[model samples]
Target: FINFPVFFSGVSMLIVVGVALDTSAQIESHLIERRYEGFLASGRLKGRYVR
Candidate 1:
């Protein structure tokens, strides 16, 4: 039923979000190496999952 579509959409969203977050973290680290500010003023971007 509608539940299947809802579950699929939710999983898709999580995947997209995970990729975006990982990409941003890489970008932030690169920028920091060049003495540039990242997404946060503090320059600390956490991953999607807490370590």
Candidate 2:
């Protein structure tokens, strides 16, 4: 029974990571379709702080 918790935690971590990756990919695809930079764009670093 001691190993059960560890196993469950590992499974949950994997699920969370998978969901995050999938969500990011979807968002990136949408952005690209709209001809916009992605969340991880490596362009001029334009943002709220960039003047």
Candidate 3:
């Protein structure tokens, strides 16, 4: 029974870290798209930006 708590804690930590990494990647992509738009006003960035 003692080991169960440790196992659950490790699993929960891993899940949280995975979710955080995914969210960070999404934010990074948005920042990159904004940066690209700032540099180029024309449609040149349309092909690279998703969503």
Best candidate, lDDT: 3
**Predictions in order: lDDT:** 0.74, 0.74, 0.83
lDDT by residue (tens digit), candidate 3, 1-51:
355555568778899899999999999999999988886877465559666
Candidate 2 C-alpha RMSD relative to the actual structure: 8.3
- Between candidates 2 and 3, name the one with more favorable lDDT: 3
Q: Global CA lDDT of candidate 1, please?
A: 0.74
Runs of candidate 3 exceeding 4 Å displacement: 1-8, 42-51
lDDT of 2 by residue, 11-31 (tens): 788898999999999999887
Clash counts for all predictions: 0, 0, 0
Q: Which stretches of candidate 2 lie over 4 Å from their true place?
A: 1-8, 36-51
Top-TM-score structure, candidate number: 3
Backbone clashes in model 2? 0
TM per candidate comes to 0.50, 0.53, 0.58
Candidate 2 has which clashing residue pairs, if any? none
- lDDT, candidate 1, 4-50, per-residue tens: 55456877988989999999999998878766444445555556555
